[model samples]
Target: MHFGIRFYLLASLLIGAATATLYFFKGHLYSRAEPLPLEKLVLATPRIPFSSLVILAKHNNLFAKHGLEVQLEITATGKEALEMTLAGKADIAAVATLPLAYIVTRSAQPRILAVIAKSNYEHSVVARRDRGISQPADLQDKTIGFLPGTSAQFYLEALLTNANLARNKVHMKSITIQDSQSALLSGDVDAVALFAPWDKRAAQALGESGIVFAPSLHTTHWTLTSNQNFPITRPRVAEKLLLALLDALTLIGENHEASLDILAQEMEMSRADLDESWEQYTFDVQLPQALITTLERELLWIRSHGNVPSGELTPVAPLPDFLDYLSFSALQSVKPSAVRITR
Candidate 1:
């Protein structure tokens, strides 16, 4: 009986060892296909609430599966993030294309790899109900508060200019976005130029106290820009980033309510306001020629403001034709079934 017990014990040990070996090799086969270095790649982001989708994607391990380490830095504004990238202080900046395009126009080095989103009716000029402000044309000769060098500023300016109103017609004051809320609430400024989360907050604080000018202007929202000087640059990385974003975009569109819940939590806003904002906003990932037209309009304004001399320097770098930036190949690589929420 003792000999039989000893033989049984020996068989059990061999089986256990073989099982462990198989498990280890199987994991290796799966993971070793692309073994990345231990270090992580950092990406700069803004604290804006709409940015929750990108933040959640990182927390949910979507980036890790693609052999990437995405680190998020809460920046004051997208322009600040672009500054970091231009200074070689950050790996990637996720923000408005206006600032990034401005930077590239000033110095033709940083190449915009992919667009995060195209701006919709997000940027708006809001006023308290008491102010009786009804439209963009109404903003003329009034004190319009804006954070200069921001996408909001660009939109506001475009709206005003399109209305045949020059910058001098309105009393414009440059204020930080955080301060714009109080500035409007306290009647410090006649009107505040801002985007959602802020717009929702402002409207709620002063009921009927807010009005938005629709069909004013829209531009590229967030774009991923990389140093053209990076040694290991690859179009493939740009493609991957777009795919990840498109995945999140698909999820947001299909499950708007659930996505808004996520946005509220990430943005620290109430569910009611998030729903309100969502009703007015649209997020589409496809790049259209309208972006180039917007860029040309922006560059013309930049020249008018003497921000960049028209004759001395071109306002924008010669980018891949509008279609080139649209990576159909990248979109094709991501199986529709991988992130499809409905269709």
Candidate 2:
């Protein structure tokens, strides 16, 4: 019986030792099986079709596929998105050429990562027929409403230029996108210069009375921009973001139906409505020389105005080299062909 007791005790010790060793190995194995935490990024963008690529990236989990946890901060306009980025509220922002140029003229701290999309007819002027604005030429002596400091204002000016109308001939009213329809339907303004989908909404609201005038002046480049230090400090994050967007672009190019579905849901619009303006957008990841030309043209406009819509005139500074505002290394690293800028 004593011999039997000794054997049982020895068995119990061996079992305990085995159990401890198993647990030790199990802990290490479990740790090795765990996934590395994804890097977090905040992308600020307007809820428009121009931002379809980023939206699709989030919806399709491409960002996660690239090991990023992207949080989208939807803004009413690209101007707001850029402001959020400049204020450190977002890591990146999708903005238009106008606002980007306007801000770049003031400060060189905003860096352009890539031009994701461009549309020439995305902006339009919706005028009230009753306001005697049958044509763009009639816009003179009319009060026009637009979202200040946005591409809306720039496009409005372009429309006027196309019409041979003086900028001072028409009264420009500052309005928000939410107020555009009411402000127009109520006769608060004679016309509104707006970007899609607001432009479409305003036109539909007016029915037979609204006349839509496409700017067709210059292509509006929808771009991804960030604070100057963001890419410099987080190069990998920036590269991953571009990679994810490239995936989204491929999806957009390869499967139009699926992409349309994603964009419609993201923009909270019916597929039909999205389809109407679908052809206007050319979604791609590019850094073209046209971007620089557009910026320079907008800078000339800003300089001529002497003051942005924000407030009184300050003496404008000389144009900074726009190339300085564009960070090509990230795009060059991801897809060399996409970086078509001269410098």
Candidate 3:
């Protein structure tokens, strides 16, 4: 073969190899198409048992299924969670009805989206044996630490009412949830109104010496709320969020055993412990009529506490339907049955 022919053949081979390499890389580029645009949301969680639906949603990628990326900000209490939402740090929050009631009266901007879970046995007034505080009545004249501005106050009030003790009769010390247990064990207070984990730990520590009285006679719901701006600016996102939560509730209802496993991990409690307390709660999707009645009753108590001006809101017989705060348009569009809260 001629030298020029050999060189030409070699050049042709090199060009073909380069062409094949380019095509290979081009195929890879197509395979790695642009990632889907995920809308981001900041959700404030109070880390309560009633918040298990939110926990399940977060853990199981339920939000992702709805094209959302939620950043969970674990707050100590629902009031704090709402504070984060107000401060522009969080878009949505899981809050107790009492705290939500307190804020909703003051600010006309926020709205309740949905109820995650409702529990009657989540909170209690724990008294120390050393203080001779054997019952809720013993809390009279006794200094008690409470997480003020949260459901702790309401729980305390309910317990006192049941015991027929006047609110002014007892002294209240403002205590954060983080310090509630230590404050009790260290004798800083005679008793404390605490929620789960703290409530469990306090009872366990006090053993036979303590009296644990659960004050929530009706229901304690961890409601999903928005900062008003979120629902107004991102209605679709809000709708999707509601849908995801409903889906989470469905999962818990249909596969209770699996839901328990998820709750055990999410609540950081033993399965047996959850089982014992399971009957106290009704974990399902419904805009219960009780929510309206409860809110109406608590709104009075909330007003009595009165850091807010009462005249700001006209005292009315029946407030707007609780559903007014909720946008079921999403639910209506997705599955009309989900919005069939009344029927």
- Provide C-alpha RMSD values for all models, in order: 7.5, 5.3, 7.6
Residue-wise C-alpha lDDT for candidate 3, range 54-167, written one tens digit per residue:
888888999999989999999988888988987888998888887767666654566776666788877888888878777778888999988876777778878888999987
Quick one: best lDDT, which candidate? Answer: 2
lDDT of 1: 0.66
Kindly list the per-residue Cα lDDT of model 1 for residues 238-339, writing each as its tens digit: 555656666677677687677777777777788887666565544544444465566556666665674432235544444323332223334345543322
Score each candidate by Cα lDDT: 0.66, 0.90, 0.77
RMSD of 1: 7.5
The list of candidate 2 runs beyond 4 A from truth reads 1-33
Which lDDT tens digits does candidate 2 get at residues 1-343? 9999999999999999999999999999999899979999999998898999999999999999998999999999999999999999999999998888777766648999999999988899999998887889999999999888898888898889899998889898899989999999999999999998888888999999999998578789999999999989999999999999999988988998988997898788889999988999898888998999998988888888764866735437888799888888888899999989886
Q: What's each prediction's TM-score?
A: 0.74, 0.89, 0.81
Task: Per model, state how many residue pairs clash.
Answer: 2, 0, 0
Runs off by more than 4 Å, candidate 3? 1-35, 305-324, 340-343
Residue 272 deviation, candidate 3, in Å? 2.2
Model 3 pairs whose backbones collide: none
Q: Local error of candidate 1 at 231, Å?
A: 8.3
